[model samples]
Target: MNEPLCPAYSVLRLLSGKWKPAILYHLREGSLRFGDLRRSLPGVSQKMLTAQLRELEADGVVVRSVMACVPPRVDYALSSLGLALLPLLQQMDDFVQENREFFPSEEG
Candidate 1:
């Protein structure tokens, strides 16, 4: 890459965690409410999702908004930099699907 990857590689170091990619993939579809994301992502615990989101927010890859309302709403969405990563992530998803059977489940 850039002699030895860009400085952003440092950002990727944090954002490249397991749930981080999944979270980013979901946000690529559109902004999602916290509950919706928790539900969409299959086995993630509330604590893990919250932690990953906070880390991504700190890396400037995602944005978090808090709405002032009776119930109070918060939503998560990708920033421009995050959006730029979508095509690459989509490619990875497709490749995974093609070889999905290779990755067996632990329950089996």
Candidate 2:
């Protein structure tokens, strides 16, 4: 079998965590504040969210902006590279929905 190239491997490494894809998906709608993202992802802990956001930012896929105000405000949005993944992610979502039988549910 042919080995995958380094660039593809790097992207996979960046997106390896369970929360990464969901975080990316949420960011698709537009910028979201830290608390907003946390609320959207019900089960994610604060630490995990922070870690994942940092990772995504480091990977150049997500942009983090901090606002100076009465209370500190942080927002996350997809970087250009990250926005490029939307169509692909949307296609994947459609595929999963269309092929639901192929992916068994845990409840079953």
**Per-candidate clash tally:** 0, 0
Q: Give residue 36's lDDT in candidate 2 (0 to 100).
A: 95
Q: Could you say which candidate leads in lDDT?
A: 2
Candidate 1 matches the true fold with a TM-score of 0.78
Show where candidate 2 strays beyond 4 Å. Answer: 1-7, 106-108
Among all candidates shown, the one with the greatest TM-score: 2
lDDT of 2 by residue, 1-108 (tens): 667676668667867898998999999989999999999998999999999999999989999998999698888999998998788778878999999989888566
Error of 1 at 33 (Å): 0.9
When summed lDDT is taken over every stretch of 10 residues in candidate 1, the lowest stretch is 1-10
Q: Candidate 2, after superposition: displacement of residue 75 in Å?
A: 0.7
Query: How far out, in Å, is residue 74 in model 2?
Result: 0.7
Model 1 per-residue lDDT tens digits across residues 15-54 = 6777998898889889999999999998999999999999
